[model samples]
Target: MRAFREDESRRNAPLTAENATRVREAMRGISFAGTPPHWAELIAENNWMDRLHGVGQSSSRS
Candidate 1:
C-alpha cells in the first residue's frame, strides 16, 4: 500500500475516474475522512487495486 503512496502519479489521479470508482467500490464504505499515515493505508490500498486491475501488493513499505 505504501508503495502505491510513493507512486504519486497514480495517487494523485482523480477519485472520480472509472478506476477510482472501482477502487471505492472495493473499499465498500471505508471512510476517506482522516489524515495521512492513518487513512493513508486505506486510500493507497484501494488505489493500488484500481491501478493493477484488481491485483494487490505482496509487501508494503514502512
Candidate 2:
C-alpha cells in the first residue's frame, strides 16, 4: 500500500509511477468472482473504492 501511494505521488517518474496507475486502471470496475462480503465494507472503510474509481482524486499531470 505504501508503494502504491509512492507511485501515485510521483507521477513525473514514469517508471515508478506507471505501476500503480496501470494496476488501478486494470482493476477499475472489476469484481472478483468470489469476493468475500466483508471486503466491500473494508474497502469502503478505507476509501479504497474511490481510489479504484479515481473519484475525487487529483493528479499532477495536466
Best-matching candidate per lDDT: 2
TM-score of 2: 0.32
Each candidate's TM vs. the true structure? 0.26, 0.32
Cα displacement (angstroms), candidate 1, residue 42, comes to 17
Could you give candidate 1's per-residue lDDT for residues 1-62 as a string of tens digits? Answer: 78777798766544545555587588887766556575557666767668656333311110
Lowest summed lDDT window (length 10), candidate 2: 53-62
Clash count per candidate: 0, 0
Highest TM-score among the candidates is held by which one?
2
RMSD of each: 13.6, 7.2
- Candidate 2 wrong stretches, greater than 4 Å: 1-15, 32-36, 39-44, 47-62
Candidate 2 C-alpha lDDT tens digits along 1-62: 99998987776443334555676688797886875687567555457756644532333232
